[model samples]
Target: MASLELKIEAKAKQLGLGPIGIIKPQAMEGYIHRLFERMLRVPNGEKLHRGFLELFDVRQAYPWAKSIVVTYADNSIYYLPNVARKHFGKFFLTDNRYNINAPARKMIASLTAFMEGLGIRTSWNEHPGVTGLRWAAQEAGLGIIRRNNFFFSRRAGSYVSLTGWVTDTDMELRSTHKEEPCPEDCSLCIEACPTGSLSAPFTMNMATCISCANSYTDSTAIDDHKLNVLTGSWLYGCDNCQDACPFNQITGYSTEIDFPGLMELDHYLYPEIIADLDYEDINDFIRPKFFYIKSESLWRWRLNAINVLINTGSSDCTRILKKLLKDPFEIVRRRAQNALELLGS
Candidate 1:
């Protein structure tokens, strides 16, 4: 009889999804404890990461899970404009998770189907209910966690989009060893972070993280710190730490597997264009692609644009802020007003 684990591995490789690894559905020793303590130690940590408490009970989150599967989607094939790269995250742009036609999506569906064919069950990655994929990757021995808290497999840099799930089947373990830690003397990622959220090695303060500041909920209110250069310039994601990492120098990104429809996103990704997006554009163009902001809260985009302009402090950025003084959302209009004043417009 063919080993189900090997067949699954072969199927994943056939779909351009390899380096797949399996492990028990638990994080490494003290990872959860260290993370929780770090988060709670910061001011307003619970408010920023309210969903994090759920990670405490893996059994409750995955009652039927027998093993955890971890895999990555390479993001090198997508072509992002320089202007877009400044304001958006590479993973969000090239992410194949929600795109039904993308190869990564196809691979995920294929694997899920293949497992179900043998009466096995599967569930998507419950990131809030589980720990970060960095721990899972390390536990599975598929990748290493950089000091910046980003995952890097040997095949790809920190640009890879992580996605996986738990399955009921007893899959074979791909690895039982861990890689060496980052250089003790190196603090490049920490030094590169503009927000100072990465104050220490491998730990992050999400409340002040540039990427975290981009997301907003109904209760999210405007804060004075938004105008600070640390969190203001880059609207959606920050790449400083990743770009500074030595391991991210992996050579094959641009020439690797292609991500479909990535170039098309260049049209609506600029800070200038995003700031003026209307309700129709929000639904048709913005939300469908970069959806960290809620549909009802498109004002956040305008606010981000204003903050970025404030950081620019250029005559052109000032002109754009003047135009935004009439934004429909009161919050956006107020933010633009303040931004223009800051720019001496």
Candidate 2:
């Protein structure tokens, strides 16, 4: 039998991963139980068992889908609005909802496909009020939670998304590890969040979070111009707190089998053009990497973008907003109209 480290190192390289690590399951036993319990404490957690079981039932897919330390790149800024704007958008700025981006979505889909192709089923869970993935990832020694309340792996920054496959293959357990201590004087993440959602270290007010808006399907409409402005340069998912963290600086880009490729931030920040994407365009060009964007809940993302662009008062965004008035997607057109009205008012 190969040593745990040797096997994991080979797997990481085969998957185009960056530096890899390991955490023994025994080391994570207590932490995983607590994390599972904590997630179950959520009101909706009771309903998640079906989903979890559905994922587990497909484990027959991959014979080699062993549990090793999975790692990705550290493109921290790519997920946030400010950093993404530099790379993707021209008219408006918003968060990089990878679910909608062509490259990112493709990567995610490919990963899922790979898992299923191996006869294993994968569950991509980001349910509200539950942190099972977080607990699992953290317990697996991928990274520790920082004061900014985001997972931070030593190799990849907070930019990595969490998704995993459970397989019939039980490989060696890597070491269970934790994040290094935070520096004494750093509070950038706390200060950068405009809505004060980072109310306390490791405790967030999801009800008041911009990211929360992207996650919910039936929450109150957050079409308020004032709230948009406070979203602080994010279009879909806000990363103000993560952007402010000093520990994230120690990270580098990912080497995962695929990272979101080729699309710019504009794809996410501008509602006027994105609403016009046909299903083929979404599936062929974008969906493989950003499957989450397909969710109808993206109305919140478009609305958030409109508010920020209007608040910037950038003339370039004016025509884009105007064009969006007749969008094929009613949600886009409605949000555009409301934004234009807010701008006029």
Candidate 3:
């Protein structure tokens, strides 16, 4: 008779999740304490970090959750369009959480169903951070936590999508901590960081992070000149730290694996096109896809595109900037004015 652990591993592979890792769930005291400390120093820390405290303890949310099974998808497998590759981070490019029919989403569904058949109660959490996944994955022996604050498997690097569920059952344990978490005192990711947001090893300033800045931030609210200049043409998200990692420097993207709606998004994401999107276009065509910026926040997306145009600096971009000056939103109009000024137009 096969053990439940072996059965779970086989099912995970069958669903294309690659492998499965099971570990005892407990309160991440160290991580939680750090978050509490951060909440005291940074602006909006209490509002942002408070909610995730409960997530650090699996029993807090699910009293019956004795263990968690973790699985990951190597996103290096998918090929993204050039525009997407340029404008968006790889994580967002391969993310299928919003799309029910996507292969990654389907893999989770199938894996969950297969696990439940083994007669174990299950509960899955959505977000990566609040769940203290970096700690969980490291404790579970699935991967090593790199200095860049990303989990890297021996094979997949940091370009992996993580999914996990808490359950009442505990499986056999083994540690696969491969390479040195910090090889040769690598500070490449910290140096490669544009905004100097990586303040120290494994510590990032959320206030200055380009990824954090791009989310839910109005264009009018972006006050840092250096941050704007540093972000360059990253209109949606940034990935400089991950890109600089030697471990992430791999090739041979899978021709067989595909992201269902990723290719089609190229139409709406070109900086020139997104800069001119109207309310209807933004709501119907754009909001459903990236969705970091909320409805009625057209200024944010337009500003992102305008900034991209300004940084790229082309004759066509100047022309588009001039046209953007006539946009309905005052913030968009002022941003276009600033972009044109920066271009000496």
Candidate 4:
């Protein structure tokens, strides 16, 4: 008969996951404490600290949860082509819309169903919860925490999506201490950051991060300088740090067939497309998988499109900016006015 760990690993592989790791729920205390201390110094850190306490209390919801199983699916290579063509060739819009949470959710759902069939009880944690998934992944021997504050698996680099669950089933925990994979002197990701968000090794100022600044539902929080610093290319997510990593450059390709291929230039945002886009076009074509923004927040997307057009510095974009001057969303109109100023129109 197979051990419970072996059975779980088999089930994970069958679901198209990259790796599986296990740890005792009680063993996560040290990692949680360190994270809590770090979270205390950031903006809105108090609220985050409180949230972390609730989420990291492994025994709070499932007192019977003796063990935790951590799993990650490869994503570094999953969207490389689209990202490359977008940044280097100025081709398509490279958003993480396709492969963000969908794959991990599917894998977790399948694993839960399989575990239930074997009469084992389980509970999964969604994102923004107290699971400390990246830290938990480090403790489970799945990866190391790199200087950019992302989990780096030797096999998957920094492009892995993590999912975790607590269970009543007891499993052997892997060693918590593993040699760090990053070189002591490497600062590639840090040097690539446009906003200096990477304050130090493994430290990030979330408020200024391009990924957070652009996608944040509150468009008013970001001022003009930060918006310009986001660069004109990225629409939804930023990959400057990851793209600059030597590790990612070498091991970023995946064998997954379901991933989308390199999108053509036409698939990206252009002056013509931005001029014609409306609410229906945004809902049907622009929204990525697992859409989170509200109807009122659609202006953020429009603002991003306007920024991209401004980056082109084409006189052609002046007309589009003019059309957007009367947009109902005050935020959109303000940005269009900014674009016109940038274009000297």
Number of colliding residue pairs in model 4:
2
Off by over 4 Å in 2: 1-5, 19-70, 73-83, 86-131, 169-171, 176-179, 184-186, 252-290, 295-302, 316-341
Ranking by lDDT: 3, 1, 4, 2
Error of 3 at 310 (Å): 0.7
Task: State the lDDT of candidate 1 residue by residue for 1-345, as single tens digits.
Answer: 777777777777888885777777654455567677666766776675667655544556788777777777667655566777777777777767557767788888888888789777877752332445667767778877788888777667778767767788777567643445688899999999887888887678776777777755433434645424666467777788888888777634456344576667677776777776686776777776666687777787777776776676544676677777787778777777776666566
User: TM-score of predicted model 2?
Assistant: 0.63
Better of 3 and 4 by TM-score: 3
Which pairs clash (backbone N, Cα, C closer than 3 Å) in model 1? Answer: none
Stretch of 10 with least lDDT, candidate 4: 87-96
What lDDT tens digits, residue by residue, belong to model 4 across residues 1-345? 998888988899888886788888777887767766667656666653465666676888788988888877766445434443343311113222334334555677889898878888888756553378887888888878877787888777777777788888888646444545778889999999877877667666666676666666654445656555455575556677776878766664544533443343235344347455886777665554325545557776677667666665655678878989988788778878976786678
Tens-place lDDT per residue, model 3, 198-314, is 756667777788887776574433756677777787887788988898888763344566677766667887888887667688888777766677786767887777767767764
**Model-by-model lDDT, in order?**
0.70, 0.50, 0.75, 0.67
Candidate 3 lDDT at 295 equals 82
> What's every prediction's RMSD, in angstroms?
2.5, 6.9, 2.6, 3.9
In model 3, the runs with Cα more than 4 Å from the true position are 33-48, 128-130, 218-221, 251-256
Q: Which candidate has the highest lDDT of all?
A: 3
Error of 3 at 164 (Å): 1.0
